[model samples]
Target: MGDTTIAPPPTAQRRAGVWQAVLLLAGSCMPVLGSVLITPILPQLSEHFGDTPGAEVLVPMIVAIPALMIALFAPFAGQIVDRLGRKTLLVVAMFAYAIVGTAPAWLEALPAILLSRVLVGVCEAAIMTVCTTLIVDYFHEERRRNRYLGLQTVVTTLAATAFIAIGGALGVGGWHTPFWVYAVSILIGALMVISLWEPTAAEAGEPEARDRPAKVRIPWARIGVPLLVTLFGGFTFYVIVLEVSYLVVGTGVAADDTATIGGVAAIASLATAIGGLSFAKLSKLGHGVLLPLAFGLQAVGMLVIWIVPGLPGIGVGAVIASFGSGVLLPSLLTWVVAAAHFADRGRVTGWWTSAFFLGQFLTPILVAVLAAGLGALPAAVGVVGIVALLVGAAVGFALRKASAAVAA
Candidate 1:
């Protein structure tokens, strides 16, 4: 008779122990930091490039280049990740980020800055993609993994919040102090090599098959819903990232006052951090309700600020929007992803990633264009709400289709 033996699965979680989790989380924060650190310094850079339209556009390019490249290269990062494992990629990418991330400030000319941004994006692709893969290797239960995703979002928000104050202050000294934060990646890079463990397939207990719908592609319905959710979330984020200062300025607040402007941006991001941490309570509501609520609240918040126009008004709007995003992002993502088969998850996600990232890249350009004729940043924020409403409709329709398809 053929041998008949079935090993029992381990009860322990698949994720790394706490210390390992901390180090990996820190590694994941590098890309977020590298991106946020540059925000306060963009105005300074615009001045450095001299007064010209091409160079002004270069400022946005420097920021957008990394985001765009990361979107494009994410798949390649996935393909290689299987061979190198997560730690190897994290280590290499972190070190590369530390070195190449700051090269732009050291050089003169806009082209150089754009080049540095592209390289930084490449490193970012590796770091982000690998860190996510590692999380799956470490966590086993669906509920725990969803919670971890919330934690990851919270961590990224905290990094952005902490770095904004630091980077803003550093920019006060000169545009380059903010860039120093990029060096933190080197330590994380090294830690990945020394501290992170490589558990065998059996030890890790990854299962015979994993469910993540993002493989080569997935049901258009699945990809479409999440893609809309992310796209709307990103468009909301763009209001803060590219235009908060401009909004403050256009609204007649102290636009020229760098300290106050930075402080306000920090406040907006703080709302995001709070929202991220507080999202746990709402997870049980599932994606269907949360996504639209998030988008609607954020859109309404934007509308309020658009009509009222002040710091207090802006702050209230930001918190509401942030809370909605905090609830919506993880809930929708977890719901769909929990249903995904691992083989197709990456590819299915490739489309979502591509759409979400494209939104991040396009937001500034589109807003800036709208601002050119619309007369101020506030108009741009309001105009974009139309798109957000469409995303909400998509999310609702997607949930219906996914449920029906699965049932059949």
Candidate 2:
């Protein structure tokens, strides 16, 4: 029989350059901004609203509400992206993000500020979903896509640290001062307006078979395991990021010693960034290798924290586990979105985002509960590490078996 492979139409040859990638990456940081920029000012916020009812609870929600919103609304944003298009939603969301994210700066009432945070979260959902979706769309080639995805992790991790510093510096002016940082999005949104374009189905390289009238469905069977794994990955990923300060303080370091705590945390963050930078080169090993390796490193790191006493163990273990987390994120992302077609990419990215943030949102609560049950936070962390080890082993064995079967 004659060969029947068909090349993509010339219209599908749209190529994205460094500028577009840069813009999309900057856009991706919108959610990170929503997440971390207000953290340093949480105490200030609590102090200001100290007299308000439930201020204790509601004050913290200003930092947390956005992640919750992303978890709940990212899928909806994905639907809109898939139906309405990526660029418009992203552009609109970025502009809206600047508006809502800065509202707390001028708002007088606590309830009003919280409401503004909710809107910030909503915009974040759209921004993150669209940014990720567009990245995959713009760079469909495996090597290029993997590199950028890995860079996404690196950029965001480093951005978190920078935002924290900025927030602290701005917080010197009062809780409201840090909020002005949100206006940075306005500049990014404007740049995106000029630099980004709506990728056509052809440009997304839609396959000939997918052109039929058949209703497009999410490839849940293909993505279910990855998404589930991502949920757990998300939890493990944030453990060091969220709890390292407490872990340091637990080791007899003063809570007020921001230098020691911040230094340890910064080292861990650097490790994570290093791991993310390495992934593009290592991704050739495939998920079967990378995922298990990442999880195992995390397990070992956490185990070190549980076993080794004092600051040495905490610092070393945090760095190791954070590096693993850095590698783990992009791996999970590429695993989910790799085989997705143009029609379904937005929803796939959305669900993956939702799964991850949901896991992040649950991390503190689950760790708290585990701490209560175990009587020590390190013990709880060790327990989670053990689970990660078991998961890694299972994934490795399953992938090996599947490979063997395919060979046979």
TM-score to true structure, per model: 0.84, 0.96
Task: Please give the TM-score that candidate 1 achieves against the real structure.
Answer: 0.84
Q: What are the per-residue Cα lDDT tens digits for candidate 1 across 234-321?
A: 6666566567777767656765797777677767766766666656666666666667666776677677667775777666666666
Report the C-alpha displacement of residue 397, candidate 1, in angstroms.
4.1
> What is candidate 2's lDDT per residue for 93-139, written digit by digit as tens?
98898899999999989999989999998999999999899888888
| Best of the candidates, TM-score | 2
How much lDDT does candidate 2 score? Answer: 0.91
Candidate 1: what lDDT? 0.67
